[model samples]
Target chain A: MKRAAAILGIGTDHVYEVDPDESGRVSAEKMEEKILYCQELGFSVFFVGITAGTTVYGAFDPIEDIAIICRKYKIWLHVDGAWGGSALLSPKTKHLLQGIDKADSFTWNPHKLMSIHLQCSAILIRHTNILMQANQMCAGYLFQPDKHYETSLDTGDKTIQCGRHIDILKLWLGWKARGHQGYAEHIETLLEKANFFYEIISKREPCFRMVIKPPFINVCFWYVPPSLQNIDQTSLEYNERLDKIAPRIKERMMTNGTMMVGYQRLDHHPNFFRAIISNPATTKDDIIAMIDEIHELGHDL
Target chain B: MKRAAAILGIGTDHVYEVDPDESGRVSAEKMEEKILYCQELGFSVFFVGITAGTTVYGAFDPIEDIAIICRKYKIWLHVDGAWGGSALLSPKTKHLLQGIDKADSFTWNPHKLMSIHLQCSAILIRHTNILMQANQMCAGYLFQPDKHYETSLDTGDKTIQCGRHIDILKLWLGWKARGHQGYAEHIETLLEKANFFYEIISKREPCFRMVIKPPFINVCFWYVPPSLQNIDQTSLEYNERLDKIAPRIKERMMTNGTMMVGYQRLDHHPNFFRAIISNPATTKDDIIAMIDEIHELGHDL
Candidate 1:
């Protein structure tokens, strides 16, 4: 989202930020504070982006509260539900994205959690003709106003691309094959598996530490080796050692051809593993095997 | 390219143009004049875009001549070969892109002339690491500096997209299946077919009019219906009548479910058909059939 803003010539200086809370979720109060600050400096805050699922901790920002603020200011509320939009398919998980329908626009990626093919994403706008107004090149060769058929149905003028790939066909086929019920079941199963992992890691105590209670399918945790088990949590030595553990264990995992899990340092926290349960094919045994492999690789470090 | 510039906040005010000559090729003198004019107004003329194969005319800009001016002005020279870059494959047509190697960067889409699957495109840079420097986010989770292997080869940081679809695999497979020699032959054959179409249209005088001598595999021409056959070319009535012919013929073509050809007005010319011979499956019989179909559907109009 920041990259997209940068491409549109909005430099870092122009981008105001509201830091995430301890749970890694953007708070409504913080967002309103930032908006007020920017406005005080004579900035017209036209767009307010609220992420449904953040990248690191699977955090879902309070969209309902933020939407109220956005409505008060008459700002365009855009929800980037790229990672968490699929949760809306399941009745049990739909509450996480509570105020998404109230958004002026929403970005959803079927590729992330829906397990559709890569690059399958959509931006749905509430108003009609706005996209065409913003992106139309009016290339006479392509979109002729005097065509026999209705030119309004010709959506090519609604985006920057003159020639787009048939990405929709695959998404449609996938959706048809897996009906709404099938998709709901898929989401429920992934969430169950993620919850199971979180519970297992929580019980493991000093050996493993849950960074925060995961709100989505991402289970982020730190595998504390025996050497640093007794180290004081506040000491510089503990975090310094904890930071190096994830990379070392990751290297071993890759070298051994066991499993692939991403690790990274998040605000104030050292390097930790972020296990995503998006794949439906992952078995219970596979999850156990992943836990066992991490233990075997990092226990003595 | 203009869309990309617009995305980067380079509006029409910043975008200066050096108009193409009669054949639709960008002359070096005109480019130098435009650059000097922009510089005189205290505007930094930093980039000069030279098209290897323009979309409408299939005209290759004089790259060798333009490169000298770009070098003199210390400007970045980018060649948009989205339409015509495949000419470099054939020895017969390679001379058309003589000074492409001197360009700072070149965009080539294999999906165009190469007949590869859609969305297979690449931007070739003259220097290495520049792309990484410009686009890297240094996201600690993805691009770790202290990885066991050479992290420099990790190309995810070299673009705005954190997760890009593997567009290179299909392109690589297509290249492998069709060797360099086979590709050259494919390009040469397409160019030959385009030339044949051009020849046939040129001979069909009163019924047809060649827009310009095509430089590459895009044969642009006009279907002069019986009503406009005797009309004076300079009159407003002739151009107005001419302009409506293509849309009418195009509507008929779509309704009849025959060949698909794009039509557009360029510069002072009225609507003309741009028949591109890019697909290897297009045969000589098909070319003849297209011309016959256009006449059968349009000549009376």
Candidate 2:
């Protein structure tokens, strides 16, 4: 979203919760807030960065009729699917990105979730000549009349950088090596693992309070340590204590080099340990071990 | 001029030399004619691509200053020195590019003559904050609001391309390897070669014509073939014959593989061959061979 906004010179975006609200569909409320904010600020452009958790907080469009309101207002809508966009391939989840076709631009990162190496992101425009219009430099040596056809959009020109690395070679090879079915199956396995963790952790004795139980792969949970037994804890205070605890736990986990997890504050909460399992190398045993280690780390506290 | 105008979202620039009086420098008279033409056509910008023999046309400053003299002019002067800007290294030749400092933006390619690699070109602004202001994007993964440097410029963001290749690495390494003194010496050798070529080619014969020979590297000349004895023909008709002879002669020379030379029509004048000697591998003998090949090629014409 930042790269696209910088390149095209317009728009602001807000992160969307991947899961649905109480209604069993992705809530458009956060998007609505951002849109209203853009309106308040008099901006004509809006972008949405959508990722995991669609089942809990965000479902796709409930009615196709919202397209009518958007067209009436004339806001240039863009979808930033740098990671979760790969889910577009799955029949079960494609509906979650329902009104996406109405967007003016879509930025998808093949590098992130798609097993491709770093830096294979593309911002595809829907309408006419845009990238070229934004970044054409008639460099005499680089773009001479004699050899114009050989110039493959000079992708360097449209980009916000000069002399960009050629990431297409890796993507082209990946497509040739692993067909769509293989990638879909990989995604399915990850989803299954995510769901398995949710089931186990929810039932465990020293339970994790899931700020988001994660419809997809991102799982956020706080450890209710024994040291906080006497304190009347609000969600904010517990989160603050978790913030103090999360880093030391995460660092200790990293020293082993066997299991890895993500830890960060999402929304208003402070540091809770979030397991974002993008690496397929992880197994159920590793997850159990991590949870056990977290419990051990928090027991004395 | 074209690439940058395109980068800045301007359209095609009709590339035509305003050298009516046939002086190498753009004279005040030519400037007057160009200004009149631009105004007649209702142009808001003037891009100046500086070159040698530019004195005959008039120095860029007086011409640009007079263009600035035109009222209500939003003329954004851009100086494109993808070749000759290296003159800044020398005190003497530096005067040639005097008012270039006043340009809104200047583009100079180190790759062309400064012995840098393919993409080591730069567009320098006196104060470059405007460029950052123009290309800012609010990307989460890239530009974050965390406790790092915020206002400081990352060279990456200022570019139009993302996932940038480190083209500057070679230039930086070269600068470090061969300090400024080494580069200046290389430039001095280039000056010597330019003077050498100017001396040699000018001495060739009446059959040869020197169009623009400066102290710098570019030396353009026309090969006027003698028709068996003394037959004068139109330069256009003469060049049409020479064109057919030159390439066939060049093919045989290339087959020998001792050398190669680039020949092209300059400024719509079919009367000349442009001999650009920026390559460090070139020598006095190579210049001699180039002249010999053209002369030998002319005999058959």
Candidate 3:
């Protein structure tokens, strides 16, 4: 609905990029080329999805590219960092999102990685109240003078939600509990864990490949059975048939109470499993247990 | 943000009501007229806010006025029963929410009175998948063919939110701990306490009004100054100014640690105090104490 609204709201719009993976990661060259492609296409607005890294037109560029591209093309750059964005607090991952301050408007989900509960998302526009200007209800009931929220910065009045859930308290409490440095340490720890998983899994036989490498959390791995091995016929049927297998395995694994792995057909690959590690409770032992469970259950099938 | 989304995405809205004075009651006739006025204004959607009171518009209607008007106009009806919706389980109060079943959607907040943690708000739609139809973001990585959430329901995908917080456990636990009739009993007890206050306060002051009268958990009262004789312009300003005066008293009350009374402006009068009796710790003694405190402090002013 929001997407359709955006499209309809603007007479003609072009998307610079959208991450198909939803993995909260994008590639460097994908970013650079997308900017260049938009410039070539003579598109004035470049809406970039920077929530998570799932793009690989290959290589990752710092956010400075946004300034560079906009300055070059005289285009408006909008960053949709809707998720995995609260990592901005971490000293370790803050470097990962360098030069984001240059973007015209950026959305960061405090609700996601910041652990502030759902709807705790914040969209900081370098230009203030841009969304308010874009979307207006013009109802006097919303702005009628009041004593409680006397300043009229009800926040709800300026937001997309009517009677928004007060997710701020959760953020406020969480921030109070874990100071800025504490939150940074938390993200740093998660990054270290993500890197650990990438190191352990990427080199394994039949592990296939990861989407966009070590630093990213969602490590995508494909399993090539010995029977289907070495035959590189990329038939549509071969792709569709292999797609049917992973869910069956996932279904049985969940029911059997051993382990459950997320599977989907990403691009050309018939079927693949994606292990998204975000839970803080997850340990190295759990990782080893998960891999062993996957192998033991998947090897025979 | 939800409010803005409703107004922008859904189109046109109004917030015609807020909690009334300490009485926690509003006139049923006034409510009916407001709903009718909304009809006159060509509102296609009726989002009823039925947290407290004998909300009889949609639920009951000897004339079936709201429904008849809605059916005539093909209006979409929704009820926001968030704060006090659990009253649906109470035999005494369920009549207040008569035609709720006819609503397209209903929002119930368990966190309000059920001791459930925050963020446990549920939007129950008559037709399922409307939320998903409204907010699904398709991607290559997360949502795809042969995925765990495909052809089968995984409750999580139906939300605009991702990495959804686990709000069900607290509710499920409440249901288990306080079985079927137990919750209803809780509501009944609370209502009984409300009635107790209403009965005593009415007996205490002959000139005192219940706003919407008895059988309501909330009691709106006015202390007719020894000088007042009529509900004229002076009385309105008197009420409004008096409402502001409570806060000055409240700050001292907070420091004194004796009791607390919330004051706010209402449509019928200027502004007045509103007391929410949901606090189980409250008793008839506390009510009397609060009154005494008000009189002691307010008499001079």
RMSD of each: 1.5, 7.9, 5.8
- For B206-292, candidate 1 gives per-residue lDDT tens digits of 898999998888889999999998999999999999999998999998888986788889889998899897777888889888899
- Per-residue lDDT tens digits for candidate 2, residues A122-160, read 777887667766665544323333331455645656665
**What are the runs in model 2 whose C-alpha is more than 4 Å off?**
A1-301, B2-10, B13-75, B148-157, B206-209, B223-235, B243-260, B271-273, B290-301
- Proportion of native contacts found in each model? 0.54, 0.11, 0.25
The parts of candidate 3 lying over 4 Å away from their true place are A1-49, A52-62, A67-83, A86-92, A104-193, A233-245, A279-289, B5-64, B113-115, B137-140, B144-151, B204-210, B223-240, B255-257
Kindly list the per-residue Cα lDDT of model 3 for residues B1-301, writing each as its tens digit. 2343444454333455533333444434545666677668876344544333332111222112344444554655556666656778778778766667776667787876666776577788888677666555565456654544544365544564555667777899988998869888877777777777677667766334445464445555554443332545355666665555555555566677777665544455534455557766677788777777766665544
What is the clash count for each candidate, in the order shown?
0, 42, 28
Docking level for model 3: incorrect
The complex in candidate 2 yields a DockQ of 0.13
lDDT of 2: 0.59
TM-score of each candidate structure, all chains considered together: 0.97, 0.60, 0.76
lDDT per residue as tens, model 3, A201-259: 77665534454464445566655444444455476655565566567667768878887
lDDT of each structure? 0.88, 0.59, 0.59
* Local lDDT at A273 for model 2: 65
Task: Evaluate residue A125 in candidate 1 and report its C-alpha lDDT on the 0 to 100 scale.
Answer: 94
